[model samples]
Target chain A: MIARNDRLSGFRARLTGAGLVVLVSASALLSTPGSLEGAQAAQEAPDGMALYEAGCASCHGSDGRGAAADRIAFDDPLPDLTDCSFASREPDADWIIVSKAGGPVRGFSDVMPAFAEAFDDDQLQAIMDHIRTFCTDRAWPRGELNLPRPLFTEKAYPEDEWVWTASANAEGPGAIVNELLYEKRFGSRNQVEIALPFGFAEDSSTPASSDGGPASDWGVGLGDIEIGYKRALLHNLRTIFSFGTEVKLPTGDSERGIGSAEFQIEPFLALGQILPGDAFVHLQAGGGLLARGHRESHGTAEHDEDVREAFFHAVLGRTFTSGEFGRSWSPMVEVLASTHLADGAQPQWDLVPQMQVTLNTRQHVMLNVGVRVPLTDADVRSTQFLVYFLWDWFDGGLFDGW
Target chain B: MAGRWGRGPFLPCALGVVAVGIVAAGAAESGAVTGRIVVAEGQVRFAGEPPAGAEIDMSADAYCRDRHDETLMDRPVRVGADGGLADVLVRIVNAPAASASSPAPEAEALLDQEDCLYTPRAVAVRAGQPLVIRNSDATLHNVRVVPDSNPGFNLGQPIQGIQSTRSFETPEIGIQVRCDIHGWMTASIHVLEHEFFDVTGEDGAFTLPTLPPGDYEIEAWHPTLGTVSERVSVAAGETPSLTLEFSSG
Candidate 1:
């Protein structure tokens, strides 16, 4: 045992000494005067095509398809620049940072060497311009068009996403509500969505039994299940418009007060406009119609007249980035107005203030939190706290980016 | 070990010198080509007869009606008196890879809309070159560009003299530009990567200059009439002149 322990200790010492030598040699090679001069001379050249061919074409092939696996020294797979589906979505600024500062700056592989000393900011931008030519197809919208998502207003751009939302009453009966939404994009402009809601709520109402005794208890049950289809009618760099329809099925227990026991159909039109200075406005207008009459707890039709409600929601927000191509923060305010279509119905107003933040280096996962405050009919309606976490599944796996 | 380090620094410098020398030589050997395009057998004709109702129905917007004295109909084909075709895009389809490295021209291509009509009808621009859109009409006109291989943009110009600038990152053959308000107004833009392109003038003449001596596939495209291509070769110090003829069936 003693002999084995001494051997292990000696092996560890030798490994440490070798590691130190390697580190010192790498530092010396990087700090050499010849390297510094070469970098300076590279900055003086204004031709981006020549620079890319000399520096990047070795690893990322001359056609930008990446070197073959057999030729690459690293195990990490290289990105394919010719695929517009992936290349068109990354902003030029992000590519420039990855090139000049190395991949680890964006939580990528360190095998990508830093060219900060070799290329100035302008030269780096020019190199990115040359890289942009790899993707010839431009039907795919640029990443700059992917604005920050608002809390209340749905975006017009179709997406493949999954979102989990939770809300709780802040000023009324103790209750917790959660919703899971899954959306899948089909064609260039169409998407299908499914949402399931379930919650636990305090039974605020009491029922009188036949024996003349009051019975009430907290309840946990499922809410209404909704299926929706949305289609983008027109889109451009500055604006996008879409129309969608949703059908809600009565799936919860009406006696437990977990959901509305009536079937409802809603159709809405949404519009997104890009404003100057990274600001944007989203507008949604829709009307809901009760497919069936309202039902009582005992499963009896109670209302003779149909219920129809119309609502208008608008959200205004602006995005600010942490760095040139880092996480983004958006602050938004939503104004909601709703009124019954029947006679003698008055409009009700509400306000929501929210903040959304990118939670991952790829900016594919995000979180939003907000407070919804009733403007009118305060006594009847209560304030609620809402939060949601969104995952853009098409970009990567949920656990891929950190 | 000393010899290896010394040679490493010298290798890159030697390569850089050779590359610069090659580029200078290629630039010096460049030549020019000139061409003229003419319509062979088709007569310029208008589309369907005028609508029975008030022509164009500009009454939807009072401003548009006031701007025009008579009815307006779109003219799809325009053939000059000398059998020359206007709005024909003549270009070298296959150019040398080195030619793509040439710097884009600094001037911006102009597309103007006056009296609720797009002027010039068609325009061609190089990729990475700016395109300036001007609205000279009195009423509101929203310019919407729809391209198959480029990012699309829509802008509203309510007043006169409104100018907007846009550029495409990639090459696309033709992009359609239209005014949503006046659905009848339309224009097309061709985006190319190289400088060997020109739109035929009133007399059906085009010139592609500073081309290296090589075999090239020259093509002439018309919006209504399809495309025609032919192969041509040029030798050093030779000024080649060619004629492209288009026929409407």
Candidate 2:
């Protein structure tokens, strides 16, 4: 037992020299039940749990689980602090920034008020330490390791999201390709995804119609559908590695230049690493093989049934938030390479530059737009405009939380 | 030996016999009492009606559910009919540090996992003392400890009769131990720097006997309710009984 007194705390509203910033209101003080009693060791750092009780326990609860709705004045859903899967991933630095600058600094609800007037950094750090204790287990990976997703290179983190991507040729016969991808995450490290592609392209062989202009020379059809699974093999604070395999089914109308009719299998290893200064890199290498039975069964003489291909994709990018946290903008560049196993097959290469930006307050719904330029075989492959609308459905609804 | 802060029927002639009983209780594990009584004892209780706890859902583990004859209600504020509180920790916090601090006790503290629940919901053990954990259930169970001041450990026990041992050098209160497979299984371990501490049982009473004669501070703590502290003076052979009451608005 230690002696307690009403000694002045080192944390004060006057630290800013502009009088009290007024973060915690008088009503909040009244609603909370604890008296901020100063302890015996005023000269030393205050206990983390004790500070948490004085400053945060009103709404965050003593157990760090959110307080019951009836106890608080507002209705915004609070996060469950005891859930390690989400809590352990949030680094202390982000929380410190949010606490000092207020909720709007992180594009969060204004119900979370700033504490710049009431608590100093040391005091806030003490409170954060107590919050960390709520989640006892350490197996869940930290969010700092999850990096930005690239157009071609999938990051190694398991996700629950949906993405709709459309790519149109810039210089060739009018063509547009679109794909809808759905990903579901299960347990801690596993995810399954399905992708459906459909597109329209101009056909050069359209015959003229009687008593009318040439028949519309455009064809629309579905493309090869793909389903895949990914499992995180290893992860740490700075890096993550995963292994995945995808199977493509020959579901498209091959005669309309829409897809490869040959059934294919692709297996790949993906890695994501965090570099200094908010920069990151993603690497993916995979090999593709055709099902001989499906390829040989087709009576087409234009295709070779005994061919294999390998591909590699790499992306480098950095993320920047607008004025602390209004919006997150990530600018990325990717290098794509592909080669056939047949003799004297020139490797194909492309360069893509893109920008991804969050479109909502929750930062779950995002949009990325980019241009794909051919490096090798430029004369044969036309440049394309690519864009995708992504929704991290795991966080919330796509349209809500704006 | 039966000193109290509140009104209770007493027998003056039974004091000598009750003194011996208190000494044996103070010895704890198998050992003789080490010091004479500079008696300090108390009862911790809620001032009025005690708060209720949520009914624990144990449907995940069949073995645990079958072991209990009726539905089990967790008692966060375990109170007897007379308002006595259980699981409260009372200690002499201001005892002279030099003489109060002792080396780790040789006796082992037992924390058993039986019926998918921790045997004693709360306990106070001396720092650096060995803590023996045993899994008595035949099915899968695990012992998980996470302490901010000390290293954390997790052990998986798939079969019965599995025993794991651990010890903490730094003293920390309310170090949580839980089982991930069974979310309802949990226990609280209070590691103390000194030996002058006791946890209240169902009767909401605790005895910190044999404290040296002096003016001292005593503190009572609970997980849900906050804490209470008071100043007391203890003299040789004189029992000082105090009552600490917790109340909610």
| Top candidate when judged by TM-score against the true structure | 2
TM-score for candidate 1, residues paired by index: 0.50
A174 Cα displacement, candidate 1 (Å):
2.9
| Chain A vs native chain A, TM-score per candidate | 0.76, 0.79
Residue-level lDDT of model 1, residues A233-351, one tens digit each, is: 65544566677888778886566546665577878777766678889877776667777866442224457456666666678899999977678899999876666565665666678
Clashing pairs in 2: none
- Output the lDDT of residue A313, model 1: 68
Give the best candidate by lDDT: 1
* TM-score for each candidate, following the candidate numbering: 0.50, 0.52
Off by over 4 Å in 1: A1-55, A114-138, A207-216, A295-306, A323-326, B1-249
- Compute fnat per model: 0.00, 0.00
